[model samples]
Target: MTEAITVMALRQGVYDHFREEGDVFEIRKEDDFSAFWMVKVSDAEALALQKAAQRQPEASRHVVDTTVIDNSELEGLRIQLAEKNAEIERLTRNVPGKQADAPEKSAADVLKMANDPTVEFMTFKAAARKVLGDATPSTKAEIIAALEDKATAP
Candidate 1:
């Protein structure tokens, strides 16, 4: 007589019994316990059950509605995305230190920038360098003197 076993029991020792030719296992899920299945079957019955299970999913697939967006809706979404991108760009432009071009500073403005603690030394040096030609002044006093000389020049 054949003994019916649970799916979990197959892993314990029941798997060794299926080595003979035409051996198969039928999984009958218990009505009360959805996760529990009783295993026992013929090779032909198991193959037929597997084929039917494959066909069931394919049949149910055709019943679901496929989502599709119309051209007008797609265009509207694209326009909204573009507007959001432009708004992001506008906001980022106003963020401190993101300026594309610094407004040209007067000699007095350069002096003020040199004196300001927050201003970077390299940035001040670049501005002063531009004004002083080949002279790359290192110290604040040197930069101020160079700018003063350039301001008084004809």
Candidate 2:
């Protein structure tokens, strides 16, 4: 039987970077436990990548050990990982609830506000004030034209 191996790291980015480097792997992000990458990598390659990742400050705390286990042994480990992730999600959800009463702004609303002509004009006027200060007629006309073009563009 092909041996199953699992390794954990501090950040998903490290795993993603390694995967992108042509490594054959399956990665899963867990909210409770550290994120992991599972693969059939040669022991040398795994150790090398683990050490390299550990050199970075953010990934230094990662536990970069691999286990050799039967395929059947993974089912229970997967289930437990799922349960732990669910619990982590639940706890994280509660944290944001405390701040929910604060005013919330959607991305669309912010974009619309930014695109408002009055707001755009104010921004342009402020920038022009800094660059052109007491603007000449030519500079004023240029600013107006630029602002109009920005306002009209999709």
Candidate 3:
């Protein structure tokens, strides 16, 4: 069997995609500030992980380390991580809610999002605020025009 590897310091966007795919991954660490994660995988899966990481828009390259553990140990680790995650969520459930973060987007990015045929008013408004730091125009055409203007600005 191929050796297992641990890929460290992954960006949050990348981790979000991986978190849903339960097979072939075990998250070992997470940092909220930089949104970095550490995950365990087989060397056999490392190439696929690298390709997936490469697809992430704003992530840096990750360093891989050898991970030595028997199957039982790996399972134990996953169970522990999941329990910790559940407990963390439970403890924080009563805290005041904050707005969900919009990914770091530029005017051009918001313009591209605005161009989506299915873009909703509230979605565009939130994206516009993130990109433009102000209220978005009320109408789609106006938002598109404003985004275009920003995209073309010096």
Candidate 4:
């Protein structure tokens, strides 16, 4: 059963009943610009009313579908990233301005390159290997003699 009560006509007992029985009946306030009525509804009636409200055109206008995925932009970005990486590798191949086919350095040139402060350590090691047949030299004089021998050799 359902009943309608006005805010002006509501008694304390109605408030007490609703407080003690938590939402056993759904109450909705209806107003037509003049008077308001508190209408009590059953559970089934409340569910039906809610479903009807969701089916209204005004409710559908608030929802948007945004589930579309575009992979072309992502693929284009990946291609551009790969091209940039390749360009970096190509530019760095001759980074020290040395060519792969440069002629082998003579003993005097090797000694000069080894003693130069601005040369990289790898060049010093290469010179040592060329003169001493090993990457390390025990004494500075031994390396110097070895370089002089190679310089005088045919």
Best by TM-score: 1
Task: Work out the TM-score per prediction.
Answer: 0.42, 0.22, 0.34, 0.40
Query: Least accurate stretch of 10 residues (summed lDDT) in model 3?
Result: 26-35
Clashes of 2: 0
For each candidate in the order shown, give its overall lDDT on alpha carbons: 0.61, 0.49, 0.61, 0.56
For residue 146, give model 4's deviation from the true position in Å.
1.1
Tens-digit lDDT track of model 1 for 26-123: 33443322232234545566777557656665534343333555789879989999999999998998764466586766776777788889988888
| lDDT (Cα, 0-100) at 123 in candidate 1 | 81
Ranking by TM-score: 1, 4, 3, 2
Q: Compose the digit string of candidate 3's lDDT tens values, residues 7-86.
A: 54444335446432222343444332232344445666766866776686432333332254578988998999999999
Model 2: residue 134 alpha-carbon error in angstroms: 27
Q: Give the TM-score (vs. native) of candidate 2.
A: 0.22
Which stretches of model 1 miss by more than 4 angstroms? 1-69, 95-103
Q: On residues 1-154, what C-alpha lDDT tens digit does candidate 4 reach at each position?
A: 3344223211222443432211223333343112222345555766675576567665343334333335886689799999999999898788653556666667888778756889876766665675557545656566667787878889
Q: Distance from true position, residue 82, model 4, in Å?
A: 3.0
User: Which 10 consecutive residues of model 1 have the lowest summed lDDT?
Assistant: 5-14
Task: Please count the clashing residue pairs in each candidate, in the order shown.
Answer: 0, 0, 0, 0
